[model samples]
Target: MSANFKVLTEDSQFQSELSEAGGRLVVADFTSARCGPCQRIAPLFEEMANKFPTAVFLKIDVNQCTSAAASQGVSATPTFIFYRNKTKLDTLQGADPETLEARIRQHYGDGEGEEIEDSGVPGHIDLIPMINKAGCECLNESDDHPFIQALTSAGGYLESDTDEQLILYLSFNQAVKLHSMKVKGPAENGPKDMKLFINQPHTIDFDSAESANAVQEIALTAKDLEGELIPLKYVKLQNVMNLTVFVKNNQNDSETTQISYIQIIGSPVQTTKMSDFKRVTGKKGESH
Candidate 1:
């Protein structure tokens, strides 16, 4: 085992580490000393631990923790399991270095080594500041738990009034290029089916939202409701002044949809300001 990563010999240790990881990604390498491929990939796995410092890396010996291996269904040595908030995101059975690295980058992203692929856009940033709070509204929401509570306040949550459906309307102070969004909620009552509409002239009701064409529609996964950043269609959400989110239902067919937190990530579109325009008098009325 590498000195850089912690080795888990007991199931309790594994559970403890996972609990402490919270929302951070946890990569567990189940290996045995007798496995030839495990030895080959140990060095590279250690290097990844150093490279992605933000993620928690662990080495679990299958022989030492047989119960833990059985629980995770790790029949083969050198099995890599990816987890976040105690939920398994992905799993690999082989010792392929490229594939392992690709899987890590797929979820957590490469820290500063990450390359910006979107042309003309600098990078993604928190677009919550650009939201026009006064214009924001949520239909079928409880009076005590308004939509703004989910966005603006910490430890605040939004609850539906009567049904599982919720229509959230948000207008931005300026045009923005939306990258992605995060919606956090309970596992059972979280949003399941979602439709996103951009640049709508006014707030859309549930009927119009269901009938109208949406920019992007997605079904939220278990990990997504646990605070994973749900990506948007980059090409479609380029110049958005407003966004409408329609929550069609909950995961467990619950009566009310509950949303605890909402985060919008994007960059504000750059446009010429009035201050940038210089006053020209046509050379002292020469043209007149």
Candidate 2:
């Protein structure tokens, strides 16, 4: 089911019906027109409204709904609240699209489908946790970067594909640890050989320190998604440049194989094991 909800500046139904919307999967945005944060989250809230039509979604302008804000304990503008069966499942303050989607997936459930065998599908990493969909389109070709609550929400999967290439524009201050890349072989449904690179200023030349996290190269045979991380003691990962990968299909066919499309996810997801580095059965585009 799909839905579109338009919450006006002054609506009396919210207070009386808030509890009615409880436990039914609701994403409420407490916003104000004057506040920049409120406006920024508006499109994202509505986008989610469309994606999860089965869920109740609405927005309350803090400036107009003073009573509602007070009743809901909204002390700030653009505070996102998720209610499942009228019970508060999650909350985000000063959040972005990606932040909202992540929260939704955490309390609601991952939109990133089930695990498959070595199908060669790639995985994604949401480098910026604060922005729900910051890395949302690392390598996505799902109808362009239109704002979808699932894509812009707190913790929604950005893009889902078997062959993908990701490019991330980062802020050194916020990124903590982001070494998980999604990739897969043609036969393997999971992700495979994943790589990361950084672009920094030439004055800050860093070399021969892999542990320092210049960048990380990771590979996987199966989906162990969460475990010990590949060490960054010698890599030196401060100044970033670019990140790229070739999730090619080397399958033994008479014709060549070239990727037609790609999808990059925003957050770190675990749907498969393998990676994007290994050779594929479809070596169609070997020349490229």
Candidate 3:
């Protein structure tokens, strides 16, 4: 009903709006009329549209315009497709408010805009660089599908060339409390089972990954891959200098598994004593 969100009943308007978006960010919510999650995320999406005036937001009912959804590779209800410069950047599967808000903030502002308040506890920060710098190697690694792209590029990702399994060994510069995580990629090739190991000292081979007891193991569904923040065991993750992750399988048991984005959010463990530094101050009105 309002211009903040345009509800499209057909494909022509969809194409026109996308064209008009040009180089700006466009968020398309491919939703179905009967989807409960679609209804739940509508308000949040609309609020984002109102908050970010520069971005284009559109709501398209997949049931009404099947062809439109097909064109965008949207096979499920409530698939959020982000576009910039008229090109697709990412796809979020379900109603994941945290990841959606983060993506919006990532492209919309350069940290100069007003900050959004999180719950009493501070929202976690990205820990990929720390892992990368600490050194990481994946199982069944390939040159064409490098791990760096998945870590660095927005559209690039790491994929196994031969099998469904991928184990990564990551070391951190400092200790950190692992909090929530988000995994996203193609529905079929995405991870279905995952295991986390804390404080691992060496590379974990396939045999070791199978035999070793993981600190945390999770079975992920389509919903989990849809930008939802999957929180880990906070107490267990404290003082984690190194970590290991194993992708056991895919949802469809595909031959090759792929992961476009893997985001770990948490804060670094404070090891320094704050009282060590003495406060030095000048008179309020005195000039140096």
Tell me the whole-model lDDT of each prediction, alpha carbons only: 0.76, 0.43, 0.70
Q: Which of 1 and 2 is ahead in lDDT? A: 1
User: Candidate 1 overall Cα lDDT vs. reference?
Assistant: 0.76
**How well is each residue in 1-288 modelled by candidate 2, as lDDT tens digits?**
234365846648674455455334567787777777677667777878766555677777766766555555566667777654333445677847887876666544333332111212223233322233333223332343222322222332323333333233332223322333333223233234444445433212112222244355555443322222333322253323333332222233212222222222222222122232233233211111
Tens digits of per-residue lDDT for model 3, 123-220: 34555534534277787756688666565435678888788898877676657778877787788888899999988768878999988899999888
lDDT of 2 at 93: 78
Q: Can you write out model 1's per-residue Cα lDDT over 1-288, one digit (the tens) per residue?
A: 433368787878988897677656679998888888898998899889887777789998877876666667666778888765555556787889999998787556324332222122234555554577777888999998889778742577999999999999988876878888888999999999999999988888889989988989999977898778788898888899999999999999999999987878776565222234344322211111
Weakest 10 consecutive residues, lDDT, candidate 1? 279-288
Clashing pairs in 1: none
* Candidate order (lDDT): 1, 3, 2
The TM-score values for the models, in the order shown, are: 0.52, 0.36, 0.53
lDDT (C-alpha) at residue 15 in model 2 = 49
- Root-mean-square deviation of candidate 1: 20.5
Worst 10 residues of 2 by lDDT: 113-122
Clashes of 1: 0
Comparing 1 with 2 on TM-score, the higher-scoring candidate is 1
